[model samples]
Target: MQPADGINLHSPPPKLKFEKLSAYKKRKLSHSTVNDTSPPTYQISSRAEESDNSSVVEPDKNLMAEYVDFVKVKPTKKEEVLRILNKKDVTSPKFFQLDSITREDMSHWGLNPGIIAQLRDNIKKFEKHLTPQ
Candidate 1:
């Protein structure tokens, strides 16, 4: 006789993953998008900065002259990235060659290009909305 209390004989269930609150919080730092869907966490370092300057730390004992070249201008706005992108229209060939990128790419890091395009098109329209009506 088949017993209802026993495990299923036909197939087994897929393994599941559960995230611990502390571990999940740490993971959140790696990808802030897990909560905030708007805006991004990082962007290009600009020409004034070394390609890998994102995490470079300056020590007090370090000579100013030696690290003079590393001084970088902080990005003030999203328009800056948009401005560079505007230079060529569409995505830049050189930009695609980058070794690393931010949370927000040409296609939301290409997670879903279709949705990214739709949102970008909306942004274009909204910017134009500010024009003379």
Candidate 2:
């Protein structure tokens, strides 16, 4: 509703414009090094060098492709693989998922330190044999 003076009380006040401050001269050199010929010790160059080969090296695509199937397999699928490994009879050669199998699982499966060491040695030997010459 309008006031007795005919002024709209609901209307907001008009916006005010402000003038910006004058720009100042930027300092090219520090007060201490104004006449010095030596380069500034603390100053870092913004320019990138063409010879700067420093970068994050990505994994080789072909090498990564070799293990892509292993990476894609789910945790449940990996456990199923462990279960299949567990089901193998004592007479058959057994394989363990070293990454997935914990110390508790090894102890539960009746593996001692000597057997674990043998298993690691065997794995290394197998890796050496399977790797390309």
C-alpha lDDT values of all predictions: 0.38, 0.39
Model 1: residues >4 Å from true position, as ranges?
A: 1-111
Pairs that clash in candidate 2: none
- Encode model 2's per-residue lDDT on 7-108: one tens digit a residue: 354554344344454443224445446778765554224321121222333433332222322234344444443443345322111123233455456556
Clash totals in order: 0, 0
Native-to-model Cα distance after best TM-score fit, residue 119 in candidate 2, in Å: 1.1
Task: Give the backbone clash total of model 2.
Answer: 0
Best by lDDT: 2
Q: How well is each residue in 1-133 modelled by candidate 1, as lDDT tens digits? A: 3545434656433443455678777787657776776655354546313233234333332222111112221335233434444443433222323444322665443324443333333432333443597
- lDDT (Cα, 0-100) at 33 in candidate 1: 71
lDDT accuracy of residue 70 in candidate 1: 22
